[model samples]
Target chain A: MENLLDKKQSIIESALELVHANGFHGCPVSQVAKNAGVAAGTIYTYFENKEDLIVGIYDYVAEKITSYIAERDDDSLEFENRFFNYWRNFTEFYEQHPAIHGFYDQFLNSPFNSEKVQNRPNMWHEWAHMFFQSGMDEGAIRATNPVILSILVNTNITSTVRIKKNFKTKLAKTNVNLDEISQLIWAGIKTA
Target chain B: MENLLDKKQSIIESALELVHANGFHGCPVSQVAKNAGVAAGTIYTYFENKEDLIVGIYDYVAEKITSYIAERDDDSLEFENRFFNYWRNFTEFYEQHPAIHGFYDQFLNSPFNSEKVQNRPNMWHEWAHMFFQSGMDEGAIRATNPVILSILVNTNITSTVRIKKNFKTKLAKTNVNLDEISQLIWAGIKTA
Candidate 1:
């Protein structure tokens, strides 16, 4: 069972790399299987079809990020500290797995990401909603829809990573200040 | 000359729709020509190749957006008013031309948006940089990188549009509050 799981993961990773390099249509299931060093039939054993595999990749990355942040979350910390901590972990995760950015951008824009798929329960979004809601309840953040706040925070993190990735060399000279970004977001959401 | 210009514009519009519906690779030059009611050879007359055509689309959309905002921009207004006006124009543009969002998301993630391409002069970014820098100079906003400010503002706008587009039916019932978003952004960038 462990071996089977490992193979499934390997296929997802391979597909992710391919999709990142080439858009979804550019990468075929057969190519993904070849890249993963598995038989074409093996891919079907794991995923019902290409769409299923794409969603699997989404779940894989989403779980990886949410779990990483959830594990390090300190509920005892004040709302501001907790916000910055979440920002740091989120930025670090993306920095380490830059390929996920491309995959996500492509996935979000693709037809494969239908309204049905988006409405499905997403771990990261759920965590964000809970965190923001807690902040509002504690009167740490402004009184508004938690979903809006979550969107603000999540988009900030993703956009920061994207800018950093796109202008890596230019930014190396004058470092992309993560603290400034965190502060800006904190200011945006905090009670004013 | 006017007829020739219209033909070029029509080709670009058709290509944008095709690329938005189908990812870049899925839409070939031949299909674009057919959709535009022009011969395959005619597309080559205006654009050197598929890549050139893609860049042309970027320039076309970028100009369309920048000019729209520029025409309505009242430089005499206070910075806050100007900022909100810019936000309103930006949001309206996206609302009217939702196809641009999918095309941009795909283009940015694809190799089509290389560093070389990104470095090319963009009217929209140039306008944004100047606006933010002026805000900082007048002490209307925080003293930090204008690029950072622009990224925050731009990302917020794009993310808001994306969320609204993805959750149109749901958002219609809830009404994604533009005022709330603008206020959040204003609080983030304004001088304390």
Candidate 2:
């Protein structure tokens, strides 16, 4: 029984590693199984097919990312601190495993869509919508439809992370300030 | 010589149709030549190879998009109307040809690097930046870096178009009044 659970976790971790190294389409099931130190049949026992494996990796990554994002809880901290914390957490996780950044980059597009991908909505997004609402109510953000605002903000974060990961130099050429960029972004949405 | 130019233009148009229908990588030279209704050798006459052909198409698309963006001189109109006119032109052109949009969508992340693609910067970007800067200077837009702000604004527009193209039915659920959405985006960037 313990073996079954271990194997299940192993499969997900292996899929993440493999998919991140090779792109979503480039990685294959056989390679994942081999890297996991399990037989190809063992992978089949855990996942139905390649699509299932990829989606499972996405779910696992999403869950892991959300946990990191939601972990920052300082009610006393200004919305700015909490907000920057989210970006910091986001950048830190991907920084730790640059490959995971690659994984997210290659698979997040809808071109790689599947039923599991469709159904397992990004848990982090829900928390973000709540954060935007709180910002609005707290007069930290403007009163407007939070949907577009949240989507646009998150897209920028994704864009920043992507651009940062791709930057080859040590120079401070990247545009966004880790701390101040948050203020600049909210400056538009802040009270009149 | 004029007849040669017509044939070359026809070949490029045909290549665009095929590459957009398939993908830059998925389509083959033989297929492009066949689709262009020219002998395989005739393709070599105008372009060096597949890479050259792809870059040529990209340049043509960029010129067309940027030229359209550059020609908007409706300074007599209010900011709102001016913004809408620009959006209308951009989106209409984007909608006219899925292939052009596809080219941008596919390459936005990792464009095929060529001397031509590298050297050929988007002139439309300059005009758009100046437009945004003008708005900022007139106290119409929030004081942010004009270039980055334009990138952010363009990100939303292109991403929305990509979403609509990719998930036709799902986006309908967003209840997005595009005009309102466009206004909202402009409003977010604009000074109150």
Candidate 3:
């Protein structure tokens, strides 16, 4: 059973890397199975079909990323520290996993996303909502819809991360200051 | 010549609508031609193939959206009014054309975008950079890289517009005030 679980996870990671590099349609199950060094039939034993395999990868990756973000939370810290820390942690995580970051944007824009979003259990969003709610209650953040606030903060971080990825070498050479971006985002969401 | 131009444009528009509805892979060149009421041969005259058609639709749509935003700009107005006006106009435009908005997210996430971004002329970004530069010079906007400022503001608008599209009816019933969201973004980049 442990070996079976390992095979399943390896299949998911292989598929994720392929999908990141070649896109959804371009990456086939056979290629994913081969990349994982498992027989093509083995994938069927785990996932129902190609659609199932793709969706499985989505859920698996989401869980992993959400766990990373959730684990960064420090309940002992104040709201601002907790919030910015999570944001910084998320940026670092995605920056480290650039392929996953690329796959994420692809998955978000895919048609399958809406279906997954409607049906999937999203702890990440829940955690974010709770954090925003706590901040509002503490009078640290504005009294806006938690969802809106979450989206704003998340977008800014992701956008900055994306910009960093797009021109990392040039940006490094130029010494572009991304530190200010976080402060700007915090300014947007913080209470007056 | 005039007739040819109309036919070419109609074909592009049809391709956009179909691609927006069904996605790039789901919508084939034949289907686009069928939807546009044009012969498959006609598409070849306007575009090299399916790949070209999809990329062409991206450039066309970008031009239209940029024109809408650019048209909203009043040179005489102060930076704040100009910024808000462009935001409101962009929101209204994308709200009315949700399909185009959906297609836009897809296009942005697609590999084709990076290729296009590298090779294509971006009048919109240039215009936005100029606007931010003027605002900075006027002491109305914070001193930062104009590209960073543009990305921050643009990301917020698109994120809000995405949320609005995702849950319009429920959000409408809840009376979620997105107007304040705009003010928050403005506050982030504005200088007192």
Candidate-wise lDDT, in order: 0.81, 0.67, 0.78
Name the top lDDT candidate.
1
lDDT of 2 at B1: 25
Q: Local error of candidate 3 at A47, Å?
A: 1.7
lDDT of 3 by residue, A22-86 (tens): 78776787899889998899999999888788778777877777889888788778899988898
Q: What TM-score does candidate 1 get on C-alpha atoms?
A: 0.87
Task: Check candidate 1 and list the clashing pairs.
Answer: none
DockQ of each: 0.42, 0.17, 0.48
Interface RMSD of 1: 3.4
Q: Cα lDDT for residue B34, model 2?
A: 82
Residue A122 Cα positional deviation in candidate 1, in Å, after optimal superposition: 2.8
What local lDDT does model 1 show for residue B66? 85
Residue A69, candidate 1: Cα error in Å is 1.4
Q: Which stretches of candidate 3 lie over 4 Å from their true place?
A: A171-176, B171-176
- Tens-place lDDT per residue, model 2, B109-157, is 5335323465466676677878877776777766766656666667667
Give residue B119's lDDT in candidate 2 (0 to 100): 47
Cα lDDT for residue B78, candidate 3: 92
Which regions of candidate 2 deviate over 4 angstroms?
A1-22, A38-41, A75-81, A114-116, A119-122, A133-147, A168-180, A190-192, B1-60, B73-92, B95-99, B110-153, B160-192
Ranking by DockQ: 3, 1, 2
Order of the predicted models by lDDT, top scorer first: 1, 3, 2
**How well does candidate 2 reproduce the true complex, by DockQ?**
0.17
Q: Is candidate 1 or candidate 3 better by DockQ?
A: 3
